[model samples]
Target: MTTPSQDRPTPQDRPTPQDRLTPDELRTLFLFEALSPEQLDWLAERGRVERREAGEVVYREGEPATCFFILLSGALSLNRVLHGDDVEVTRTDQRGVYSGATRAYLGDRVEQLYPHTLRAVSDAEFFVLPADEFAYAVRTWFPMALHLLEGLFFGTRAANAIVNERERLLALASLSAGLTHELNNPAAAALRATAGLRGRVTGMRHKLAMIADGRLDGAGLHRLVALQDDAVQRAATGVSMTAMETADAEDTVSDWLDERGLAGAWDLAPSLVAAGIGVSWLADAARTVGAEHFEAAVRWITYTIDTELMMGEIDDSVERISELVGAARQYSQLDRTPLQIVDVHDLLDATLTMLQARIPDGVRVVREYDRDLPSIPAYGAELNQVWTNLIVNALDAMPDGGTLTLRTWREDDRLMVEIADTGVGIAKDVRPRIFEPFFTTKQVGEGTGLGLDISYRIVVNKHHGDLRVTSRPGDTRFQVCLPIEQTAEATETAESGETTEAGGAAEASEDG
Candidate 1:
């Protein structure tokens, strides 16, 4: 084989003009196909073929919609740069053409001005048609003009659809962020309580073992029982008390009880009583068991109560977790089809649960639900997404943590759900675009600015409902209004247990 350098074509070795484009070759381009041979030749003389390397910048947006281009080879990526970042707008392959000539020919106001830039991804070739010639061709050829116009319209629509999708993705990102934050709290609390309960239960088992072993007399047993009682009480107090205070009180009682061996004594109570030690004998034994034993008894009681309280806490935590999971399932409507009859409360509750992970530690969530609310036909998952976005956004505004109040009430024929947050209020200027896609006050990468936009679509476009927001410093509320009835099919499905809508479910509330 010849060496690569020797095999490469020299400048003189390249094809001449006659070889590159024959007279017939000029007529083959789709847009120019209708031109007469003489006209095609005239056009070809003015046309310029340009080559761009990979990663080359071809054009900028808002640069006059001048000469149109037909890509003869390679790929082109299109993007809009906003706020110092490149947001990809679209991408086209080799068969694509970048022509805004229809707008120029029609004399319509250009919707997008450009210094918008285009870059080539690989070595590429394009045919640039002069503005005047292209305009003349478009106006003179009805089919060509119509084709160009249709292409332009389709391109515009595609661009719009891409933009809408981006906005939606951004909103989803924000909602997910908020949801992650919401999940952490109850999860952490439950873990801590579970750990505490394990320790308490261990200690309780040891004390019961000692009592079963007959290691203590009736008096010691009585003192130990009393200590167990006191421990339970103290544990209850711990629930309402500061952690440090609770720990200190617990430690003191535990130490005093240990000194008297009251742990062992209380552990022996049942055996002592079984061995014929009476209550009177045990009371007398308490006097002999000493102040240390009494202290130990008190401590043990406190701890027992603490254990119980912790158990209750764990139970409550589990319930909350269940509620959250249920809410999520309902909100996402994962088990159901895309469109279903949904209970508004289920959607709201799921949204709250999802955002539960995000609410600040100091913030409290309150709910006032309307008992008379009814189910509506909707896309449950999408509607849940709407609620999740709004409520989570509200939680984010309150950095120091305030109250998030949710209310549902019936107005006229509509059912309304309102979510209000006590956070730094929305500014007037930004409020206008809050529901616009990809608009955000959050730091870059921290938010996508799509939450409210998607919410608006879900409520207004999909559900045929109303979504409105009212905000002030320390108070921001979002109101969602939806119809109360579903179509006959929805009702029939619901009756058959094939579908479960969230409407008519009891209003539920959560506090953080």
Candidate 2:
């Protein structure tokens, strides 16, 4: 519990003579049901019953675990802390249900700390045993189980660390590859446009010298400059043409250029047509320069339009490259604060941009963003990983081709982002175990089954948010809901189980 409801009772409460359990009474507990009478007697002699009034805490999480507890009466709640806020795991009044020092049998091999905060929802009683005694009893009485438990614990731990790291590397490679491919197209286009622009400018210079070789007066030169400006304006504001319209227009321009004896009529006519310049503009240029200098004027004007189009191409290519870089920066959140108020749309868009190379043309992506949604405090890069995992998962689901829809909006105090896809949905039998660690319906090697598990920790455990999914044959929606009013600390570390340090918030770093 982040805030205690009442003063925590000091750990001075002790059992009276009647508070102890006899061997027969201890047999009633499920844990000791199979133990021998001598073993039960050993526990009965050492264990005692303790009482906690309603609203009093039995144990706070992260404290050195000193006792083993089994509920005897009343209700209790288990709460986990994240960002200094309590997230209730469960509330139960079941007799014989256990809590506190669950892993005491492992002894000093691992840190003996309470994993969750336990509080008395109502007046409660627990049969408590000291950690050392419990550890000794278990080691001596159930040596086989002790060995098995140790193996299970350490083996699962080792397996997770190894598999998770491998998954992270593979995911990193995929992301890097996708980003590299997405970046290359624009970079190559810009390079090509720059090369073409150089030759166009050189040709225009030679045409300028030929035209101004004392044949044309100042008025003709001025008219040529005005016509060049008009061509640029038309290129910018030109209405797009249909394929048929463009073909007919280019044919007509080609015929006009041929009649005027201009070379490269076939090549130059398309450039003119593309700039929305027809024969009438060419004739006006002819009159301004007169027949004596018309050829030079047309060549000069054609080079001018060609360079304008080429320059526009270069601008677009450079702008595209800049946008990709910006998206990469946004997705990576490099050199930025770990936590901040961020627009959900920005993160979603950036993730989409990064995944662009992986998204095939058959699979369309649609965005349905509520621009009015309020910004929420979050770990920006981590949240981008969440979006990345969900979106990539959606893409994977749609193998044959389908729509991937990303929609965001607000509901009450929560901002909701839904990554929905049209694909064969999750099976009914498989749905319940989807959040469990390493549980997957997919074939081995194809999935580590940690994607949803890690995603849940980041959203629910780290951010105190919610992640849910709804599915059908043609549609599956994974929606993440985040609180708009974040009452927790602005900065928080992600150190849940399987995630040991900063910059590594569980789930293949959300790389999945």
Measured by TM-score, the strongest candidate is: 2
lDDT of 1 by residue, 1-512 (tens): 11122232233333435324443665655555556665565556555677899988777754776666666678776654432336454566635355433344544433322224567778887766656556555555455645766566556456646765675576556556755555566788889999988886777676665557775678678766654554445444433446575455445444444555665544333222222333444345457556534433433443466577778778877887777667667766889987776777877777766665566679998989886677767788777777777777887898888999889998776778898998999999888778765679999977766567657656654455667788899989899877665434333221010111112211110000
Which ranges of candidate 1 are over 4 A from the true structure? 1-310, 361-366, 392-405, 420-449, 469-477, 486-512
- Work out the TM-score per prediction: 0.50, 0.84
The per-residue C-alpha lDDT of model 2 at residue 227 equals 83
Deviation of model 1 at 263, angstroms:
10
Q: What is the Å distance of residue 116 in model 1 from its true position?
A: 34
TM-score of 1: 0.50
